[model samples]
Target: MGTTQLESVPEPKYWHLKTVLSEALDSEFSVGEILPNERELAARFGVARATLRQALEQLELEGRLQRRRGVGTTVAPPRMGVAVGTEQRVWPGVGEDAWQAVGCTLAAPPAAVAAALETPREQSVHIVRRSRVSHGQPVAAELLYVPQTSAPELSAIDASSEAARARVVLRELHRLELQGQDSAVELGSARADDARQLDRLPGAPVLVVTTRYFAEGRTAALSVATYRADTCRLTFGASGVEILHGQERQAS
Candidate 1:
């Protein structure tokens, strides 16, 4: 008879450490409470510093912890739920949108954005930069692209200043009758500019949202917003109830 061999299951050290630290956070830590320094924690857990840090990074990504450059890590508050889908189709900045425009400029968008907008590769478009703040912390950064043909009424006077150009482009966009809108969300890493706006390190985990605005039977504009995955829960549709993180799970 031939001997049979069983495969062994391998579990990563960092994953196990992440679970232990997560449970500790739930039972023993309070929001805004600082954790022990990395070296001390690693020693206490009998794990390498790099292993401990990997666990910490996972906790931060789940919004269970917050880490700053110079300051030590602390327990994070519950993730804020931002509404992504609403019943009415309205232009961005038209209603009670949370985004605040920072600046605008004329530049050629990325290839993906150009393809979405159906604009020529060499054509310059209006790029509006915006940021979102939640609970006094920056949570997201957005780049809104408007093709020149969509906002023909914008004059050279508005182009003199960044803020002026942003307003002008939005005003012209509102003139069009919004037919529909569609959006998709995916995981991504923050780029340099987006990282600066989100107050995170480069390559930090992010939730990238791509939205396309339709008008006059054509694509009018495209918006790409990157939300801090560590501190945000992108919610769709309406729900009266809110879910609190780090709280004990109810019996199922």
Candidate 2:
């Protein structure tokens, strides 16, 4: 690659540089390849280091690059197509689900979750924590809330550990006939717990997916999943699209 001076344009210099860098990424770089240092990049583009930094930050926000602690900046993988909705009728933790149950606890949910669950504010519910990984990287962390009313049988189970409690809660909850599910997606900043689970810095951009599972004419369970916005593109509808790091495939 040769040094090329950027021409002045009406738009911000960093924004224009971002465009040029994006093109170069496609034509000259491979995924996971570390980019040159900021000084080198600035000198090559004939832009100030400050402008180059701005452009790099924009690229990282757009999921085109990753800034690792020790690895520096590298080309990021393509956005993974995460299926948020499907026609198949099934409960979570059932039948080849991508999430892994990490732990479970009994705690009063947040006010919004309590309202959604239609439980008293002080009532403790079963909170099942789960995490999803793709390409060996954590992509999402979830909190599955099951009201005691939703999984009454759990009371009888002698769950000795957190994982055991999670299993029993899931088992009892699955006994309910799954009627349907609905989900809503919105932008969010990673909270401390979610940030740790997702391996992102505090306040990093995230996509919050809130889902309600229905059974017996009531909201049986609620799930709040936090996905790394840079790594995920939420997909809806029955026809699923599976996007891997560097490839795309269709799933039905």
Candidate 3:
């Protein structure tokens, strides 16, 4: 909102504001540092409160700021990134890991998941739901699908089975070479169920990462993970150079 010369870079005011706020958070602002109220910030910037709020939203999406009901906005600490790859099934929260499974079910799969599993639309697959929390907030929710072929040994699994089926499915999958996987990301809103599991409001932005596992030239499994864009920066590759635009950005 701050006035600038015409020759200045052509960028949205909110984008500029987000950059300024991000810089402040990275340097002057400590974790949990309470920022000036929105009204004060808007007045100082010479922009409408709504405009300033938009800027704040972007910063919050980058995990730079967090706002509470009664409390003002504050700096949020960095979020940790758990590597995503076609690797062994490491038990959630059991191997000193950040992933934790909260529930499991065998239900009719979504069309996308059903296609990936190469199974009949009517057939059900094990949906292993897990949550990944870093610092104090939930960062991600994962839905791992286990096709019947991949879990033939689960016939004995029951309601009180203690997540044994999920464990067994992952174990069988690990035996293969796990040669490669194909993945695509898209912007999506959190469904009601995912919202509850992720501790987010319905329709909140999420980074939907879909993966198809491969072993010995055949499909192994499929996993769809929805990460809270407001609290996570998904890192993928050698040095994590991808932009933090969430699911709303155009593919590069």
Candidate 4:
């Protein structure tokens, strides 16, 4: 009989480091506690700075750690559960919505948004910028596209300023009878503008949520909102008690 050779299995350094760091976070660290400097951590772990950084990035994505550009890394608190689905279908800005209008502009939306809104490519739409803040931290940035036909009541006077137009666009949208709404969520990287508003680096992890508003048997508006994947737990259903772990979902 021929001798059988055992195959060697090698684990990725960063992945292994991430596992070790995760345990440490659970037993050794507290929320908001500052961690050791990257240089010291890398040396202590006997790993390259790049490897350590990769592990740290993974931790941050899992909401286990929080990293700032100027400030050092710190333990992150539990992700906030943000309700995405509700029992009743209602237009945004109708109830006590969490979004706050930032600005508005008349411009041609992206090709995808135009297609979703069923609008002509050449026609400009009302682009309303909004931001969501939770626990005093900016969590999401959104761009709501409202076609001219959907919000025909808006006037030139309303477009004179960004703030005024934002309110007008939302107000006009409320006039229409909202028949239904739908949303889809996926993982994505933050765009430059969105990253700036979210106070994160460009290309950071984000949960892209695309929502469509229906009125008069047609798509009235389309909203693209990007939430910080590191710090938000997008919730659904009637009861808001359900919580999701970001790392487990990401791994799947």
| Highest-scoring model, lDDT | 2
The clash numbers for all candidates, in the given order, read: 0, 0, 0, 0
- TM-score for model 2? 0.85
Question: Candidate 2 — worst ten consecutive residues by lDDT sum?
Answer: 239-248
lDDT of 3: 0.67
Model 4 whole-model lDDT (C-alpha atoms): 0.81
Indicate whether candidate 2 or candidate 3 has the larger TM-score: 2
**Superposition error at 67 for model 1 (Å):** 1.9
Q: Which model is ahead, 2 or 4, in terms of lDDT?
A: 2
Best-to-worst lDDT order: 2, 4, 1, 3
User: Mind giving the per-residue lDDT tens digits that candidate 1 earns over 1-252?
Assistant: 111111121568788778778888888888889999998888777778998889898888887887766778988887766667666788888866778888888888888889999898888998998888865789888999998888986635336667767878888899999999998999898899998888888887889989999998989999998998877787776432122233433221
Candidate 1 runs further than 4 Å off = 1-10, 238-252
RMSD of every prediction: 6.8, 2.7, 6.6, 6.7
Q: Residue 177 of candidate 1: its Cα lDDT?
A: 92
| CA shift of 68, model 1, Å | 1.2
**Model 4: residue 244 alpha-carbon error in angstroms:** 12
User: Against the correct fold, how does model 3 do in TM-score?
Assistant: 0.70
